[model samples]
Target: MPISSKIARQMEEASWIRKMFEEGVRLAGQVGAGNIHDFTLGNPDLEPPPEFVESLRDLVVRPRAGMHRYMPNAGYPEVREAVARWVREESGVEVGGKHVILAVGAGGGLNVVLKALLDPGDEVVVFAPYFPEYAFYIDNHGGVLRVVETDGQFRIDFDRLEAAIGPRTKAVFVNSPNNPTGVVYDAAVLARLGGLLRDRSRKLGRAIYLVSDDPYKKILFDGTQYSHVFRHYESSIAVYSHSKDLGLAGERIGHVAVHPAANSAEALVAGMTFAIRVLGFVNAPGLMQLAIRDVLRACIDPSVYQRRRDVLHGALTELGFECVKPRGAFYLFPRSLEPDDRKFAKVCLGKNILIVPGVGFGRSGHFRISLTSSDRAIEASLPAWREVARAYATV
Candidate 1:
């Protein structure tokens, strides 16, 4: 009764990840916290890399005049320049600061993008098994979400994608080294997607933007190659966050980069800058912006995550759980023991194991496990995982 009816309804359909996380908290009180195996959130247990930590220490120890002052809505010039160089290196696109706008993180950058691009009733097509928050983000901008299910291997079903696009379609969003399912989109797949968008844009008489959320681009595994959106499509935008790569989740810093050759690229950047102000993010945190700028090339040595993935994925499969090994990101999405994933998650909960049901990501009969747990936590959870697996095993 206190909140708006809209938000009230939204809260009812809130993220299962948070739901399970809260469940973890509630259950932690009963069992010693150490006995709880909470794979609910994608939050890494790792600390920020030494490079970023030292950079922050240096900046803090030697404060400059106006370092904490309000900056341009786009961001500090030097920070933007640093991000631009990183963009050029990773995406193979010749981008400059003019093409970039800093934001409160990939989440906020995405909201800024939708705020700038979406009109009332516009449609944004998303693939199934997606990050659940995308639905809320699209609704925030008065856009309709059209979910197209991926193929068995989590690859885009091109035919479904073609059918999903209509005259009012504004954009197609993708997250590589995806959230729940860690499938990485390769350049070949992107090439096919670019061709499709080009053909569809001409037929629809509008440019349908390919909006890529690449917060985990640098957190790849097993030498997996990441395809940058700008390199695959001309009418595209990229959102990058320092959270995953730098282990700076609480810093709340990231940037949006519009493809230099995109349709009305300059105007798109300007609109996003304005949206940044109107959305109240104004600019990314100034101290974080400056700190990340100095360590633009630094990352948390993704091998750490790769090892985590191998440990979890191997143990699951060996125990008869079916899952695709994650090529990147710190998650393992495995098919649930039964047809109902919620039931499976409840079973996991019985063992003091916390995982989000895959139905939350628009899929059923699966569940997500975050690989951000420490070796100790994983070791402790193995017995519980085995116990749960046996509970569902055929007698």
Candidate 2:
């Protein structure tokens, strides 16, 4: 009689992470904001670089005629060309404006690509402990999500992935420097993945697209670099955003770069462009597209995040928490001190600490900690974190 059953079920599934954050906010009011250790969201707290700000200001003050008007559904020609040039340099693949389609954000870009690709009942493979929204995205296009778990270190398990491949499999979604787990997929692993896709495609007599979600591509730590998937996988679609890297998450601007060498590249790009329009995005925010076009070279300093990661990871591990030191992105997945992560998270809440249970990201026996908050938040939260850990130690 009210919302559709489909939506009701999806909402129930997606509520856990948001519920934690909301509870954290409600508790903050009760205990005073500084007393709660909230690590439930990956919202980056850093401001955009000075250049990005200047570019925005410049664009606003010296407005071009019809600057706010809609350009092409694929995005402004100049913006697409700029993005294509950057992709070419980074991926070492020759792509031009025609291969790029701009969308509201990485999430929107993914939806657009999925809309263009998935027929009803098609299967999409995803690695577990992934961004939970992926299930919703795949479902939006009438595709089923077939999940395969990652290795102990959160790296891709090639054997398991190979086994997951089947005739219905149309795409494999990858998020390197993954959201819940921050492990970066190395070049060697990417090469292997590419080879597998090639062989599988030949055997099945079909093409399996590689969808690379890369919002955290530029936020890496320890001098690590992201493996450009397009170089290894020809039938790859790179969904990228300036949200995490430029601290423009609220602006919602990103693009999808189709591999120039992909099979029927022009057709794929056209389909993505049409999908973006039909899905109601029409185009990415004009101001943000222009804001990011020239400032493609800019990034919020990774060192700031690196220092935060070092402090949190080192302090937690020293206090007896098992954590995989993240190489990119702003979240850390730490093994729960107790057997049931939900109960362990509740124990944390008792200590005025809020964290997402690992099951929210398709894993259990652990929890996720978003390190994107202010350094003051991390430093202030440490004592409470230690108290929670100590409580678990005794249990």
Candidate 3:
């Protein structure tokens, strides 16, 4: 009764993933953690890559003078320059320090972008089966979320996407190697998307920015081709996190890079820096900003996740759970045996196999299993997964 109705509604509407994660903790306690396979959270269990570890250690052992003091709301100039160099190499854009704004994490960086772009009731389009928190982030800045469903392969259907864009449309969010499906958006796909947005923006007579949530850009597998979002769209913004690639989820380090080619690009960066300060993020942690500057070239080997993906995807597919083979990231989205994903998720819970239902990702009829768990957890979960599949077949 003390809480506002808006928050209550948000609680009811989303965070199924976090709810399931909490449930996993409780069940793990009750059943002994070994008895439960938690596939709820995408929190990685991998150690930070050795290069990242070394960089942090060196910086910590010999701190720079005033290293702990506040930095430019945009970030340490040198660190931003380093990140700019990394982005230039990856995105093929000649970005400079002025183009980047460091932030607490991808989540914080997203909020910064949304705050900078949205006016009240402005609409932001997102792909279906997106990260659930996107809806919340949109609302935090008084923007509306418009979801456009993807095709069976979880790739964009341009017609559907175009239909979703209209007056009041401010931006479109692209998340490649997507959170639940783990499918990478290829260069061809991005090029097509860029074309669609360009035509639509021309008709609407305004810039429809493309904001990419690219935390998993470095987690590619099977020689997955990486497409720079900036390469495809001039009005694009890239928000990246060290959470996935560096296994620094808890460290909460990330950056936002406005496409150097974007119109009013300098003003956009200035606005984002203002948002960072007022949003109370102030800036990304100083130590992390400095530490990662030297280790931009290294990330956790994709093979570390490729092995887990192979084990999990192969076993699930073998057991008759239809799934699109994931080429990147560490999640598998498989069709739920029943159309009611929440009901099916409950059934998995009965077997101590925890998964987030597809509804959590703005899609239904499927559930997500995160490979961020240990190899032992994946191996152990298989028999239980097999039992669930067998039971569902008869039903």
lDDT of 3 by residue, 84-178 (tens): 99999998889999999988999999999999989999999999999989999999999999999999989998999878898999999999989
TM-score of each: 0.98, 0.98, 0.97
Which portions of model 2 show Cα errors greater than 4 Å?
A: none
Q: What order do candidates take by TM-score, descending?
A: 2, 1, 3
**lDDT of model 2 at residue 46?**
89
Q: Model 1 misses residue 194 by how many Å?
A: 0.7
* Residue pair clashes in candidate 3: none
How far off is residue 86 in model 3, in Å?
A: 1.1
Which RMSD values do the candidates have, in order? 1.2, 1.2, 1.4
User: Relative to the unseen true structure, what is the C-alpha lDDT of residue 131 in candidate 3, on a scale of 0 to 100?
Assistant: 92
lDDT of 1 by residue, 102-214 (tens): 88988999999999999999999999999988999999999999999998778889999988999899999999989888999999999999999999998888799999997
What tens-digit string does per-residue lDDT give for candidate 2 at 1-395? Answer: 49999999999888887788788878888998778888887888889999999999999899989999978999999999999999999989998999998889898999999999999999999998999999999999999999999977888899999999999999999998889988899899899999999999989998999999989999899999888999899999999998998999899999999998887789999999999999998899999988888999799998898899999999999888888889998889999998799999899998998899999899899899998888888998888888887887732
* Candidate 3 or 2, higher TM-score: 2
